[model samples]
Target: MLTALKEETYKFCHEKIALLGLLVLLVTTLYSTLTKTINKSTLIFAFGAIEWIPVIIIAVGAAFFEMEYDNKTIVMLLYKNSSKLKIYLAKFLVVFCYSIALALGAILLTFLLSLLTVPGQYHWLAYYQGHTILTNLLLNLFGAVIYCFFIVGLSFMLIMLVKANTVVICIGLVLAYFGASFSTALMHTFPTAVGILKWNPLNMIFISQQLTRGSFALKSNLTNFQLIIATVVYGIIFGLLGYYLFKRRRV
Candidate 1:
């Protein structure tokens, strides 16, 4: 497992897209910070830079698998690492680490931007959305991490099923952008079944909002704990399905 992990990490580090993704995150965050007028630094600090995270996660995850197939290196990988489970897990771990790194990078960049642009406008201890600014930021980062897992799992499954990176990315982007709204529409459209529908994976996308907005629970019909659990469960399910397909696929 450790050897597989090291090999996966080495491959990811050598991917040009990996570095490009990081650069894009920093540049977008910087642009967003500079363009927005300073009102509440806490809001800017927490969300200003993370708007593109999901998009990047989807693209990166899909591209990782796509590259292997495109380069016809998956057969070599399978031959080298006798354990399919280790290869799948190592790839997932690398992507998860990339997601966390992106989240941390966004947070760090946003923090520095906030300090530089409006040093005294907000206090870290100041309460916002029923928690201190620092707490909200931490929770937001946590929510982002959870969402990353969900996306990676779903992306892997889609890639295995469709064998197309573009399709996976498109579906992921649509879900990332419209999933919450779609859930809301579902709740209203089928008011009688909300109790069941509210637990759907689409609804889990609102985990970030529920974490930061005190009133979001009422709107999402799910507590933060429930959303977190549901999201992780869905991630695991998708990941397992993807692995099953991968194991059965002809190399």
Candidate 2:
């Protein structure tokens, strides 16, 4: 397992396209941050741009698996004693770790840049009163990480099933962004199915937004606890399904 993980990580790290994606994330984040006010709220908003990070990582994950199949490398790995489960999980873990690291790096960079560029505008105290800045920021970051896992894991599951990088990435992004909005609107229209609709994985994508800002919940009936639980359940389901499918794949 350890050897498989190291091999997966090394492949991801060495990919020029993957490195370019990270560079794009950093550049775009910096540009977006500088355009807005440099404060606690703005810092969070800047990192919110990281919603696209998972999409790039999803492509990476799909490519990681597809390349092996294309080159018939899976045969070599099996002969060298690597189990299907180990390779599958190693790819998943690498993609998952990249998603989390990209999020953290973007958030931290935004905070530091905000401090350096506009120290006078740093309003951590006013933005989140009664709670220390660190506490509020940490809680918010935790929620963001949870959402990241949902998207990354869901993408992993889809890629495994579809085995097409572009199709999976496109479908995943649409679901991640528009799925919740449309579902919430429909739930409002029907009003009776809110209970079941709220549990949809796509609808739970905005869990972090609802967590950090009370105003974000004005349109929805879901509580933070419900969203958190739904996110966890969906993440686990996606992960398990991916593992099952990979284990059963012919190649």
Candidate 3:
């Protein structure tokens, strides 16, 4: 498994999808901080705008496997005695780790930009006087990464089911674009179902909103703990489904 992971990581690095994702985060972070008067708190929120980037990149990375299938190269990998689970896991880890790295890179770049642009205008410890800038950044980073994991899991399931990059990309973008609104509408229209709706995987896509916006988080009717649980449960479910399908798929 470690060897498989290393090889996949090497492939990911060679393909440069992770590099591209990092570059996107860099550009978006610069555009966000330079174009707007954003402080540390707001800077954290701004980077969340491009959180879908990891999903997009991960989807693209998953397509490499689809290409393997199309080219009949995956059979070679499968024939090497590596369990299908390990192969699936290697790809998933590549995407998942990349997602987390992208989020961290955004946080770092946004902070540096904030330092250069905002200077002494805003204190890093402003979010909570008790918490330092680094602490708050970690919290926001955690929030962003939780959603990234959820999206990666969703991508895994989609890649397995569709086996096409374009469809996964389209569906991912659509969900990222409107998933929050749809959930909000559902919650408002059927207030009684809010409890159940909060657990929906799509509902966790914009979890950063809930993390940053106190009022909105309250309105979400889901405590941060519940949201975390929902994200983890959804990730696990999608990962299992993807692996199950991949194990039985004709390569």
Candidate 4:
């Protein structure tokens, strides 16, 4: 499993598509640091926007296997000695690790570039984040990564159901874009939609930042415990469904 995982990790890391996502994050980080404000949370959110990079990039990685159904070549690989469970596990592990490494790498690079822009703004990176820039970045990197995997899982679930990554991505974007609009409508109003819609994975980054900055973390219309359980259950179900689909594929 170790050797297989290493090879799978290499496969994911080698993808140029993932590389572009990393580049985009680095660029966004540099851009984010230009703001004049210098609060702890501001420093956090500046680089934090980069967290969303995986939300986009991981979708591309998830597509690697499902999108291959169209190629016929990926189907050929399925006929070989590997078990479907192994393939699915290998891909999932690779994507998961790649997200962490990618996020960490970008965070470090962003931190370095950030010194020039934000310049001594991350005291909170030390206070709230365990007293070191690297440590804080690592923690956020991992948290953002789990969020990324959950997003990837969601992506695959959509693909398995719809049979097209493009369809999944499109639907996701529509849901996200309009969801933001809906959240804005509710932000000031005291209606039912007021406390919800912001916790959505699509808009989670912005909400996560709001939480970090001491603003309201996306008010859970469902309450905290309910949301946590729902998220966990959601992850487990999709992971099993994705693995089951991989196992049952006729290829």
What lDDT score belongs to each candidate, Candidate 1 first?
Answer: 0.82, 0.71, 0.71, 0.57
| Model 2 Cα lDDT, one tens digit per residue, 1-251 | 99989988998788775687678678777776657655566565554554656556666666777777777987787777557778777877887788777767766776677777877665655546345555556556667667766766676688678888789878867875787688778778888887776666667766766776666566556788887887878877888888887777777
Weakest 10 consecutive residues of candidate 2 by summed lDDT: 126-135
RMSD of 3: 2.4
TM-score of each: 0.94, 0.85, 0.88, 0.72
Give the least accurate 10-residue stretch of model 3, judged by summed lDDT: 46-55
Model 3 whole-model lDDT (C-alpha atoms): 0.71
Candidate 4's residue-wise lDDT over 1-251, tens digit each?
A: 56556656676667665676667676666666664454554445436554455556446655666645765756555665366667667777766666666676766666675676657755533666333544544545544565565666676667667777678767655644564455555554646555455445444433332323233343434433444444555556677887777666665
Instruction: Please provide, for model 3 over 122-241, each residue's C-alpha lDDT reduced to its tens digit, 9 standing for 90 to 100.
Output: 766665534666565666667767766776677777878888888888887777778778877888899888778767766776566556455666556787777777887887888898
Q: Which ten residues in a row have the lowest lDDT in candidate 1?
A: 41-50
lDDT of 4: 0.57
Q: How many residue pairs clash in each candidate?
A: 0, 0, 0, 0
**Candidate 1 wrong stretches, greater than 4 Å:** 41-45
CA displacement after TM-score superposition, residue 82 of candidate 4 (Å): 4.3
User: Which model, 1 or 4, shows the larger TM-score?
Assistant: 1
Better of 3 and 4 by TM-score: 3
Error of 2 at 34 (Å): 4.9
Candidate 3 at 64: error in angstroms? 4.1
What TM-score quantifies how close candidate 2 is to the native fold? 0.85
lDDT, candidate 1, at 45: 42
